[model samples]
Target chain A: MADHKTKASAKTSSPSGGEEAYVPPALANLIGYYLRIAQEASFQAIRQGTGKSDLKPGWYTLLTILSENPGVTPTELSKLCGRDRSTLTSTLNGLDARGLIARRRKAGDQRSYGVKLTAAGEAMLRKLQVIARAHDERLDAIVGKDKPLLMTLLRRIVDELGNGYPPPPARGLGKTSRTR
Target chain B: MADHKTKASAKTSSPSGGEEAYVPPALANLIGYYLRIAQEASFQAIRQGTGKSDLKPGWYTLLTILSENPGVTPTELSKLCGRDRSTLTSTLNGLDARGLIARRRKAGDQRSYGVKLTAAGEAMLRKLQVIARAHDERLDAIVGKDKPLLMTLLRRIVDELGNGYPPPPARGLGKTSRTR
Candidate 1:
C-alpha cells in the first residue's frame, strides 16, 4: 500500500498535476469517520512501538486491569476490558499458558474462578508499562493541552452512544457502568 | 457475552455488593484506551443501525469515495479508506461480485483499473445515507454543540499520530494527502 498517495492519482487530475488531496464532502465532516481513522492511526502506532512482545494490544489493558483488581474473575475482566467473555477467556488462556496469569477456583464457588496476574505476569506488565507510558507521552504531545478535553469528549461518546444502542448491554447482568 | 457485566463481578468485591465499575488507574487516564473503546462503541452502533445491509461498514466508506471519485483506481481507494491494497482488492472483488461496482482499465493505463459504483451501488449508498444520517444525528445529540471541537481533536490525532509513526506511508507512490 506504499503507493497509495501517488498511484491514487491515476484517475484524477490535481491542480499541481500530482496527487490531489481530496476527501468527499460527504465524509469530510463525519465524526465517525475521524473516530475510526484516528483510532486506527493510534492503534498502529502502539503496535509499532511495542513491536513483537509477550503482551498484545488488548492484553496490556487486561493485565493492567488485573494488576489493579487481582482475583478479578473472567467475567469482570470482560467488562473492564469491554471484550466479550469468550474473547476474554481465550485471552486469559493464552496468558495462563504463558505463566503470565493464574486462574484459581473462587473462594465460595468451585465452578467459578478468580483470575490474577502471576509473578511472571506482573514482571511482564511492568516491562510493558514502560512501553505504554512512552506511548502515552507521544499522545500527550500530539493532543497537548487539549488532552483532558479530548478525553471528556471521548468519554461522553462512550457514555451516550455506547449505551444508546446495543445487543442490550452485552452478556452482562447490570447496567453498563465504568467508574471514571 | 451478555453475561459480561454481571458474570464479571464474580471475582471482585463491589461497594454495592454487585458489579464493580472500577478501571485500573493505569489505563483510566490514557487517551489510546478511550479511543479504542469509543471507536468500538461507535462502530458497533453503526453496525447495529445499518443492520443486515448490502454494504458493510468500511465498504460504505469505499463506495462513498467511489461515488464521488468515480473511476478511482484500487490504489487511490486504498489510501482514501486507509486500507491496504490487498484488503481493498478483496473488498472490491466482493462489491464487484455483488454487481454493485464496476471496474475497467484506465484510459492510458492497462495495468490499473478504475472502480465506480453501478446504479445498484448508488442506490445502496443512498439507502445507507439515511441510516448514516440517523447515526450522525444520535452522535450530534451526544456531542451537541461541541461536535466541531470534538472533530478538531480527533483530526489532530489522525494528522499528528497517524503520520507520526510509520509503515512508511503504506503502498503509496506520493506523500499522503487528503482534501478537506
Candidate 2:
C-alpha cells in the first residue's frame, strides 16, 4: 500500500501547485513541523556520513531498545515506541534477516518473543551513535547560543502536551501532589 | 498493488491473535515520530469537530493562505504548503466542487492561475477558525505556559534545519546576521 501510494504520487514534479489552497499561519509556530524538519536534516546528515547505509532510523531505534533492555518482549517495545504489532513484526523480521538482532520465544509465553541485539548490532549502534551525535551537534550549532533556550522550550512543550509530564497546577491552587 | 498489500497483511493478521508489539527507543526521539504524532493529534481533532462538514486541515491551510495573501497563485500556494502539484491539483478540484474558492487564469502567464476564496470559503474558514482555536487552546492547555518555550525551541530547530528557510550561510569567520 505504501509502495502504491508512493508510486501514484511519484510522477508529480511538485507537490504544492494548486488553486484555492489553504495555508495555516499557526504552522510557523508548530512544534511538530519543527521536529519533522530537524529529523529530516538529521537523517540526511547520517545518510551522507554513512555513505547510505541500509540501516534506517527505525533499525537504529530497534537496536537501541534491545541493547538497553535485553530480553524485552516485542509487545513491550511496541508500546514504548507507539507502533502497531504488525509494523514491529515486519521490522523485527527485517532486522533478524540482516543478522543485527535475534528473537527467541519467551519460556512461559509461547506466543511472545524476546528480542536482543547481536554483536554486529552493537557495533553498528556504536558507530551510528557518532553520526547521531554529529547530527545533534549540527542541529545545536544551527541554533547557536539559543540551543539551550530552544531545548528548554521543547521540554516545556513536551511536558505540557502530555508527551512527558502532567500539566502544572491551576492558578492559586494549593501545593500540587507529586506525580512523576 | 495497494489492495494486494492490504490483503496480504490481512491474511497474516487473521491467523495471529493480533498481539501488540514494541517499537525501539532509538526511533522514539526522532523528530519525525513527534511530528507524525502531532499531525495525527491535530487531524483527529479536526475530524472529530468537523467530520460532517467534510473540511480537512489541508483545506483550512489553503483558506488561511488565501485570506492572508489575496490573489495568490496556485504555484505559489503549492510551494508554501510543501505539497506536490498533482496532490494540490486534486485538492483544488475538491475545494472547487464545494464552491469554497475560485481560480482565474493569470493575465500575463498562461500556465499560472490565481486563487481566491469565495464568500462560502470565507464563511467556512470563519467557522473553522472557532474549531481551530479550540484545538489550539487545547494544545496550549496541554503545554500551558510552556507554549512560548516550545515555540522558541521549535523555531530554533526549524532555523537550524533550514527546512522552511533558504540555504545556510557560508562557513566563514565573521559575525552572523540575525533574522527572524
Candidate 3:
C-alpha cells in the first residue's frame, strides 16, 4: 500500500486509476498486522541510515545489550535476545570474526566465558546508534507527545504476550546457577 | 527481560536473586526496541497457537493478501508485502508446492497470472485465522478501549516513516501500468 511514497495524493489510486486502494481486509484492524508493517519500515529506515547491509536483524539488539551489560555469558545473552543458545553462539561468532566482540573466561569459572563488544564493536555501535537515534527522531516526529504512551503500550503487549511462553532454554546452565 | 515468563514475580529478579534487573540502558526507551520485542512475542504466539513451525514470517501475510485480493499479480503481491519480486516469487512457489495457492493466467493477458488461494489454501487460512483471532483478542485484552486509537497511532507511524523510503521494486511493471 505504501509503494508509492512520492505520490502522496495517490495513496490508494494506482497510476492508471483503474482500481481503488487495496486495504488488506482481515489485516487492517489487527494490531499484529500494524506491528509487522511498522517494524519493517523502522528496520528498513535504520538499515538505510546505517548504510551497512552486513549487520543482520538481531545484531543491533545484541550489540546494544552488550554495550549496557558487558561480559554477559552466552546463556544470559540468549535469554535476553529470546533466541536459542546454538543460534546465539553462531551470531557471537560472526561478531567475533568481525573483531567486534571478544570472549574472556571468568576468573573463577574457568569453563565459562563472557562476551563483550571490543573497541571496534564499540565504534560500530556508536555509528549505528547515531543512525538509530535519527530513525527514532522520525518516529518521535510522528507520535510527538504520545511517544511514552506508545512505548508503554508496546511494552505492555510484549509483557502480556510473553507471560506464558516457553522460557529461553537455559540447558546445562542448571536451575540454581543460571546467569542473570 | 521477559525470559522468565513462568515466574510472574520474577519479571526482573532471577532465581538466585544475586543480581538486580539487567536493563538495556539505551534500548529501554526506544520505540523500535519495544516494537521488535512485541513483534517477536506476537510471532511466537501465533506460531505456537497454529502449531505450524513451517509457515515462516511473511507467508501468512501473503496468504492473507491472496485470500482478499484474489487476482493480484505477483508484482502487486510484492508491493503489498514490501518485498522484492525475486523473493516474492520463491514465496509464491513455496505456497504453490504446498497446494495452498494456484496461479491462473489472466484472460486476454496470457503473459500475466493472478494468484489466489486454492480450496485447501482457504481451509488452511480458516484454521490459521482462528488462532490469529485468539492472538488479537489477547492484544485487545491488553489495550481494551484504546484498540482503535492504537491502530490509528500505528498506522500513522507506518505512513510517516514510509513517506520517503525506497519504493518496492516494481521492475518492468512500468510506472503507469503498475497493478494496484
**lDDT agreement with native, every candidate:** 0.72, 0.57, 0.71
Model 1, backbone clash pairs (residues 3+ apart or across chains), number:
26
TM-score: which candidate is best?
A: 1
Residue B167 displacement (Å), model 2: 7.1
Q: Among all windows of ten consecutive residues in candidate 1 chain B, which has the lowest summed lDDT?
A: B11-20
How far residue A144's Cα lies from its native spot in candidate 2, in Å, is 5.1
lDDT of 2 by residue, B54-133 (tens): 76755766787778777877666755665534567788888889998899899998988888899998998888777777
Sorted on TM-score, highest at the top, how do the candidates line up? Answer: 1, 3, 2
DockQ of 2: 0.13
Top candidate on lDDT is: 1
DockQ for every model comes to 0.36, 0.13, 0.31
RMSD of 1: 7.5
Candidate 1: misplaced stretches above 4 Å? A1-22, A164-180, B1-22, B164-180
The candidate maximizing DockQ is 1
- What's the TM-score of each model vs. the native? 0.79, 0.65, 0.77
Give lDDT tens digits, candidate 1, residues A1-180.
343235543322212112223456898788887788778777777777666765687678778889999998887677676555677767778899999989989889887899989999999898888878888888888888988888888888776765434423334455455432
Across B1-180, the per-residue lDDT of candidate 3 in tens digits comes to: 234443323432223211222348788888887787778667766766655455554566778888888888987786666555566777788889999999999998888899999998998787777777888988999988878878888888777666545443333343464345
Q: Compared with the true structure, what per-residue lDDT tens digits does model 3 show for residues A1-180?
A: 234554432333222112222358788999988887778667766766655466554577789999888999998887666554666777888899999999999999997899999999998888778777877887888888888778888877876776545443334333353346
